[model samples]
Target: MGIVELKNLTKSYKQNRGIMDVSFSIEEAEIFGFIGPNGAGKSTTIRTLLNFIYPTSGSATIFGKDIIQHSKEIRQNVGYLPSEVHYYDDMKVVDLLKYSARFHGNLNSTRMKDLAARLDLDINRKIEDLSFGNRKKVGIVQALLHEPKLIILDEPTSGLDPLIQNHFFELLAEERDKGATIFFSSHILSEVQKMCDRVAIIKEGKLVAVETIEHLTKNKVKNITITFEQPEQFTFTVDGILKREVNGKEVTLLYSGEIKALLQHLIDLPVQDVLIEEPTLEEIFMHYYE
Candidate 1:
């Protein structure tokens, strides 16, 4: 069985909203990405997987055990960072971290200190006094200190500076190298592209496409730009063309069909310059939505 599995998972609330027929699986030691825009049921799916909320229908499993029935056991090997982080106002950062670590049994003072130093977190300061970025650092430390087998992050890079974000990605890479499975959920496509092995895109509470970054960006579509000679208009149509745009003498399009077919169509056009390149993750994702 996969490390994580969901079978026709669905959740509903008033007004006919919430996730519907959501299903995917994460293999052991894989860095799987769950990506979607806000309000697309990303959190709902994560919450259900964690059993923080029950699914209206369908089911999921983590660590090869049922999510709902074995919540306690599943949690023991899981570390999670929610999109928004909150902490006790009165407790110092160190105290809060210690309190969190206590639940998982022995404390790893050395690892805690290392992570704190790497993140430039002031563990001595009160949680209330910390900046949003600092609080996020706390969340990172809390999630990783346990060294859990599965690490789940929901938009975890919020409030972090670019330099720190780079460091955080490095840490995650180190964890992955050590055989930890990661389920990273984010709306930021570039980060997901940079970090995950495979990605599952969700739109409007439904699974859309799941594929590797390379295949999604390279194999699926090619961005074509054509510039024609003055006074010579160029127009051609072929299958698998999307998001076509024209600006005076230049035309841009996303082409996903046969390259030979596109070449055949382009042969008759009044073409002066033509450029073809791979599309970005955002472009690919938008194509899926379209």
Candidate 2:
């Protein structure tokens, strides 16, 4: 069985809107990416999985246990970091982290110290006095302190600088290497491409697609740039061409099918130079959005 599973999960708030029939699964030690634009039900699905809100219909499970019925038990092995974090202002960072670890009935003093040092977080500082990025660091450290089996991160890099984000991602990679399953939700397509092994895309409160990163990208879009011997009225009829651009004696376009056919057609044209490469995740994302 999968470590995480959802069967036709639906959550409706009002006016027939909210996530509908959302379903997916995460295998043990897999880093699954959940991606969509704002208001696309990414958060809603995640909340349901965490049992912060019950689904209107269907069901989900984590570690082979029902998410809602065995929430406490599931939570004991799960660590979550929300997009935004709030903490008791009066407490010191170290004290709050200790409390979080104790709440899980597992505290590793060495791990806590290591995380703080790696994140460059000052544990002695009061929660109210830290910067947004620093507070995010605290949240990261707290969530991973107990070394839970599952990690759920919702836009976990929001307040972090690029350097800290790199450090945080490295930490997550280490965790994954140690047999932890990760559920990474983010709208940043590049980050998803960089970190996730597979991705599930949602749009307008419904799932659009879910596939391995390789399968999702392989031969899906090809970016071709060509320079002609002379300026010509560049027009070609082909299937699966999504975009085209023209410049003086140069043409660039995105194609998604039949490389052999495209090459056959190009052989007869005034193509002086050519460059072919895979499209970026953002380009592929636009293809799906369209």
| Candidate 1 deviant stretches above 4 angstroms | 231-234
Per-residue lDDT tens digits for candidate 1, residues 141-190, read: 99999999999999999899999999999999999999999998999999
Residue pairs of candidate 1 with colliding backbone atoms: none
Q: What does candidate 1 score on TM?
A: 0.97
Ten-residue stretch with the least lDDT total in model 2: 212-221
Candidate 2, 90-124: lDDT as tens digits: 99998999898888987899999999999899999
Cα deviation at 163, candidate 2, in Å, is 1.3
Against the true structure, what is each candidate's TM-score?
0.97, 0.95
- Candidate 2 positional error at 243, Å: 2.4
Q: Please name the candidate that would achieve the greatest TM-score relative to the true structure.
A: 1
Backbone collision count in every prediction?
A: 0, 0
In candidate 2, position 228 carries an lDDT of 93
